[model samples]
Target: MRIGKQNQAFTAIATSDSETITVRGLDLCDDLIGKINFTDYFWLLVLGDKPTEAQRDMMDACLVAIAEHGLVPSVQAARMTLAAGPDAWQGAMSAGLLGMGSVVAGSSEAAGRYLAEVIAKAEADGTDIETAAIASLQDHKINKRKVAGLGHPQHSGGDPRADRLLAIADELGVSGRYIETLRILGKHAPGIIERPLPINVSGAIPACILDAGWPLEAIKAVPLLARAAGLSAHLFEEAQRSIGFIMSHKADEAIAYDGKTSSRNTKAAE
Candidate 1:
């Protein structure tokens, strides 16, 4: 039996024939291959239109800012997967991508949604953005919920990448309500959250990109695409100077076992 009601598949992304290929209604070879950068192509593929100069620059900056993070857990997982099965590079990449959950590389999407919510609440209540942000932060504090994209254990003083991204957004003149919301959070977060939780890269990424008109639903795609580039590099190195097994060995050495003893005397156990 058929699975669903639809009789034919549909996609506006691309199509190919004997002589030519089209992407978002543009000729791939003649119009895009040599003319557009990957970041612009990415924008066309996702939003079905090319990005403005500011949007493209902001996107490129974010992609570069998040691309590699020096053997983060996801990188380690990818490396270890490669070590377990040296020939399966795709499997290793999948393992790495799978590790990007709420706590790791995926935090950008969460922050984007939070920023959107604050903006929406302010618009609904006819209040200023800062007031709305403060209220949302206070609510998170009371509920013991994390205000996503506001802290980094390693960058306690501040995250340089975040600082740089925000600066670029400001310089490009793309800073908007979301960026303002993020800055307001940074300013008042200590008072509400009771800690100096500065704006992290995750926060900066969404703020800048959203101001540049990226959809909230696809916020995660930015980091995912960027990390894929990083993962490819890690996998390439794994093929040559393999460290997957080394990481596994270190993990084994680091974790201590503290289980129950065998049910017998020492001589019997021996």
Candidate 2:
């Protein structure tokens, strides 16, 4: 029954006695309940401190921007899981969360890391941020790796959410090196990548939040948290309208099987 470490379970996040609950050393009821919103509370939970007003606003904007992109794959997965087992709401939610990987809601983290790399290289080389950004884009192009968070298929002109978040960052005076780097990348991407790869919301999120002092490592948390709210809404609607199986049926109708005939089909042919 022993695990990696015996008699040494520990968590700095929170603890509670019968009389009180604490989160990151703050009294949950007394210090947090009405004094902070969920986004600020989330920052406290992750980074062990409340966010500045700019940080909170930037975070809130990113959260709102990413939440509820309707019927995305993760939402579809969650709805379908719920349809299969109507009683297991937890399972449905789990299905949705599990589907958020590198290609989907998880791209924010990758974009954040890439931005950080550009900033670091610029700092190290004593060149301007724009130069470093273009160089980084060139590297990605050379390697045939995707420049994460650059383009949106649906928003070919540009991502409105991304523009709004960056504007909010500027209004709040939190727009800094990362945000500048992101803009530089966007400016140069068409020339370097040979296409108009405008900055998407995923890219904007990390740039703004990172400039606001969020840890780059935790950038994915922003989207995951936002999508959880979206998924909850979806699952609730699925329960009410029962569309999980309808989505499944739509998928069946959308795709044509292009393989060897099934046994029944082959028998019919014969």
Candidate 3:
């Protein structure tokens, strides 16, 4: 569908002959063997436009942030679906994508509401910011009790992506109010917040997106943006693995009427 014309030639030549230049074998028509980079070729094949240097850098940053996660819910689902059959890679990858649709995995936009709620509470109370922050932390720990963004099963201490993202944000001249809030809390309310746990990547990603002027609702789209790449690789792996051919569920277990058997186990299994 009229993709692009950059390092490409218009071929009206007949394909019935052995001299045809199919999309699969178009190395470099003239001397055709300079080892053109796959990254450049991939960008050319898709998008229909060459990305600017800055665009490439940002895209590289985001892609590098989540290239491969081991046995995450999505990856687990993908592998499970893949391990059953040879040609089920697409099914397995689709299964993985389904598991990733959430605010917690969706990143900053979905998190904006929670951040705004906490910040608004501080602003509305008009009390000392440090005091209000401490109170909010306590209240959240008790009442609302909801947290979104930044999951690190492998790296328990923190997310490695956060530092690189923050550095890029600084270079992009993005004002990070979300990150600023953490700094404020760490400096002033260390007794309650920072001492217990540190600020995470999701917290700063919100600031970076906010600096980009995107709406808070945009968080949900990130899974589609991010996991899609992972899904592509996973589907390919599943296709190669000869697993995940069919989908089936095991039979349900017996349920005890009273306390004879551990019904709690049944419920937990569910």
Best by TM-score: 1
In terms of lDDT, which candidate is stronger, 1 or 3? 1
TM-score of structure candidate 2: 0.92
By lDDT rank, best first, the candidates go: 1, 2, 3
Provide the lDDT at 125 for model 1: 100
| Evaluation by TM-score, superior candidate among 1 and 3 | 1
Provide the TM-score for each candidate, comma-separated: 0.94, 0.92, 0.58
Error of 3 at 229 (Å): 0.2
- Candidates in order have lDDT scores of 0.94, 0.91, 0.54
Better of 2 and 3 by TM-score: 2
Cα-based lDDT at residue 80, candidate 2:
95
lDDT (Cα) of model 2: 0.91
Candidate 1's displacement at residue 212, Å, is 0.5
Number of clashing pairs per prediction, in order: 0, 0, 12
lDDT of 1 by residue, 62-93 (tens): 99999999989999999999999999999999
**What ranges in model 3 sit over 4 Å off?**
1-60, 85-90, 101-104, 107-110, 123-132, 144-156, 185-190, 193-196, 242-270
